[model samples]
Target: MRIVVPIKDNSGLESEVCEHFGRARYFVFIDVEDGKVKGSEVIEVPFKEHEPGDLPAFIKEHGGEVVLAYGMGRRAIAYFNTMGIEAITGASGRVKDLVEALLKGALKVDPEWRSKGDFGRHEF
Candidate 1:
């Protein structure tokens, strides 16, 4: 499976998972099979700014099957869902650890996640 993780830096597997999915500076593309990681590639966010569907479209173009992020707004998650990509929000820690947890089925998805101010914002 191909997983996309929004990150703060280019540390590869050690990269810190960015708190906000839409505003992340970098992204790590990981390929896993048989419960083991096969390879990974990192890329910078393509645009200076983005709208609701851009990131999800980008992920689809790259053949991503899953998204791992600490937090994401409802619209973004909906977009991913529309594209047939699984958005696993409320994820944290290093990219490697998250991948391991995914393979182990240890990550949780909180359907009611929301920011402090309103349901419109994304707060990690």
Candidate 2:
């Protein structure tokens, strides 16, 4: 499976995960098999400016099956859902660790947790 994790830096598996999906600076795209990371690549989010619809399209273009983000707005989340792409939010910590946990069925995503305040900032 192809999984995409928002990353703050591209140093290694220990790099911090980014908070926002659309505005994330970089995304660590991993190819998993048998619950292990077989291959991976860091793709830079084209620019800082992006709309809710653009996110899903970008994921689709990159052949992403799942998105691991710190926090995603309702519109963006809905867009991913519409595109049949799983959006996992409230994620923090290392990008590779998150992917590993997800592949191992250790990570549980709470899709119901919605931001009530400003949509851009990090809350969890």
Q: How many times do residue backbones clash in model 1? A: 0
How many backbone collisions does model 2 have?
0
Off by over 4 Å in 2: 108-117, 120-124
Q: How many clashing residue pairs appear in each of the predictions shown?
A: 0, 0
Candidate 2 lDDT for residue 80 = 87
lDDT for predicted candidate 1 compared with the true structure: 0.83
lDDT of 1 by residue, 53-108 (tens): 88899899998999988778789889999899998877778889889988999865
C-alpha RMSD of each candidate structure in angstroms: 2.8, 3.3
Worst 10 residues of 1 by lDDT: 115-124
- lDDT by residue for model 2 (1-124), tens: 8888878877546677776665567778888887788988888777567655876788789999988887777787888898889888887788767877887779865454455325554222
Q: Rate the local accuracy (lDDT) of all candidates.
A: 0.83, 0.75
After superposition, which runs of candidate 1 have C-alpha atoms over 4 Å from their true positions?
108-113, 116-124
Prediction 2 TM-score vs. true? 0.84
Clashing pairs in 1: none
Model 2 residue 40 lDDT score = 86
